[model samples]
Target: MKLATISVGGRPTPAVALGSGRFVDLSREGGLPSTLLGLVRGWDAHRGAVERLVAAGTAEIGPEGVRVLAPIPRPERNIMCVGKNYYDHAHEFHGSGFDSSGGAQAVPEVPVIFTKAPSAVIGPGEPIPAWRDPTGTLDYEVELAVVIGRGGSGISKADAYGHVFGYTILNDATARALQRKHQQWFLGKSIDGFCPMGPAIVTADEIPDVAAMRVSTRVNGELRQDARVADLIFDIPTLIETISALVTLEPGDIIATGTPAGVGLGFDPPKYLKPGDVVTLEITGLGTLENPVGGRPA
Candidate 1:
C-alpha cells in the first residue's frame, strides 16, 4: 500500500492512500505507536499494523492535490549516495580525476560513496535554496534511492534484499567547482536544500523489480537525465551488503544509487541551476519529487 506523511490542520501526521483519491490518518489508530524510524526499526513487527490499518478501512484518502510532506522528515542521519555506478557515467568522468581514467578509466572494484547532510533534505514541493556562490554552477543528478526497512550490520549480499523497506527518488544537487576545489564531494553536496526526496515511500511488496525501473530528470519541463536502474554496476543488494559491512544500516536510512549519464556537467558547455529553475525527479514506480530553485531565505 502507498503511505505518506501529510499535514492537515497544521499537525503533521502519517497517512495511507485509499482508492478514489482518499487518505486515512494512521495516527488516528493510536498514533503510529512509535516514531517513523521506530516503525522501520521494528518493521517486521509493525508491518502487520500498517496492513491491518489499511485493511480495516481506517485510512482517509483525499484529493491528489492535498499537500504531501517528506515521508520521513528529519531522519536521524545524513543520506548516503553512491557515485559513478553506471558504465557510461564512469566513462564520462573517466579522466576528470573523480573517475579512474579521469575520463577513460575502468570501473572501480567497489562503489564510491558519499553523504549528504540531513540538513540538506527538502520535502516534495519544497523550495531548493540557490547557493550564494557566484560561480552559478548548480547541477542535478537524478537517482533511484533505496530505503532501509530494517536495521542490520554486516548484512550479506545474499541476504540484503530482506533489509530493504522500499524505494524513492533523489535529486543529488551539486556545486561542481566546490567539488573540484576541495578534492572532496561532501562540501559540494551538503548545501542546505540540495537533497529533494519523496512524495511517499512505496513499500517493498509493491515494487517487485527494483532493477528494471526507468529513472529520469526534468529541469523546468526539459528532460535532462534519462536511464534505467538496470544500468547500475553495483545493484541494490550489493550496495546494501557493502555499506552494511562498514556501518549499521538503520531503518529510514536512504541510499541513493548513482545517477546515469546526461548530467549537465557532462555537457560541453555545462549547464547549471539558477534561481527560478524547477527540477523534477521521477522513478518508474516511485512518485515524482519537484523543487524550485531560489536564493537563501531573506
Candidate 2:
C-alpha cells in the first residue's frame, strides 16, 4: 500500500493513495497523523491493520482536499546516503575534478556512506533553494530510498529485504563546489532544502521485485541521469549488511541506494542547475519527484 502524510482539515493525517491523484484520510477526526516515523515504530504490531484498511477501500480524502507532506516530514535522524555506488556515476564525478578520492575507478570494496541532516528534507514539488552560495554548483542525484521497518544491527543480506517497510524517490540535490572545498560531503550535501523526498512511501508488500527498477533524473525537461537499480555495484543487501555491522539500522532510517550516471557533472562542460530550472527525479513505482530551482532569498 502507498502511505503518505497529508494535511486535511487543518491537521496532518495518515493517508493511503487512491491512485487518481487522491488519498484516503486515515486519521481520526480533528487530529494530526501519527507521523510516518511513528507508524513505522509500531509497524510490527500494526502492519496487518494498515493493510486491512487499504484492502477495504476505507479512504476519505482526495488531492484537492489536503496538503501532502514528505512521508516522513521530520526524520528522527540523519538520512543514510550511499556514494559512488554506481560505476558510471563514480567515473563521471571523478572526471568532474570535484572528486577527492583519486578517481571514481577507486570503487570501494565497501559502500561509501554519508549522512544528510534531517532538516534538509523537503516534500515533493517543493522549491530547491539556491542556498545563498552563488559560486556554488548545484546538481541532482535521483535515488531509490529504502525506509527501514524493524531496527536492528548486524543484519545479513539474505534478510535485509525483510527489514524494509517501503520505498520512495529522493533528489539528493547537491552543491558541488563546497563538497570539494570542505573535503567532506556533509557541508555541501547537508544544506537546508537539499533533500527532496516523497510523493508516498509504497510499502514493501507492494513492491516484490525491487531491484530491477529503473532510476532517472531530468532537468528542465531534459533527461540527465538514467540507470537500472540492478546496476548498483554493491546492491542493497550488501549495503545493509555492511552498515548494520557497524551501527544499528533503526526504523525510519532511510538508505539512499545511490544515483546512476548522467548527472550534470557527467557532461564535458559540466551543466549546473540555475534559477527557474525544474528538476524531476523518478524511480520505478515510487513516482516522480519534481522541484523548481529558486534563487537565494534576497
Best by TM-score: 2
Predictions in order: lDDT: 0.80, 0.84
* Per-residue accuracy of model 1 over 108-147 as CA lDDT, tens digit each: 6788888999888878888877765456678889988888
User: Which regions of candidate 2 fall more than 4 Å away from where they truly are?
Assistant: 29-33, 55-58, 102-105
Query: What is candidate 1's local distance difference test score?
Result: 0.80
Candidate 2 lDDT tens digits, 1-298: 8888888867876778777778866664223337767787787776666666667665555577677788898898899999988998877776677887543465666788999999999988788897544555888899999999988999999999998889999888889888888888987888899999988999898887887789988898898888998899888889899989998999899998888889877787878888899999888888888899888777
Model 1 CA lDDT for position 31: 39
Backbone collision count in every prediction? 19, 0
Q: Candidate 1: which stretches are off by over 4 Å?
A: 18-21, 61-66, 95-106, 132-134, 296-298
lDDT at residue 262 of model 2 (Cα atoms): 90
Judged by lDDT against the true structure, how good is candidate 2? 0.84
**Error of model 1, residue 174, in angstroms:** 1.0
Candidate 1, residue 240: CA error in Å? 1.2
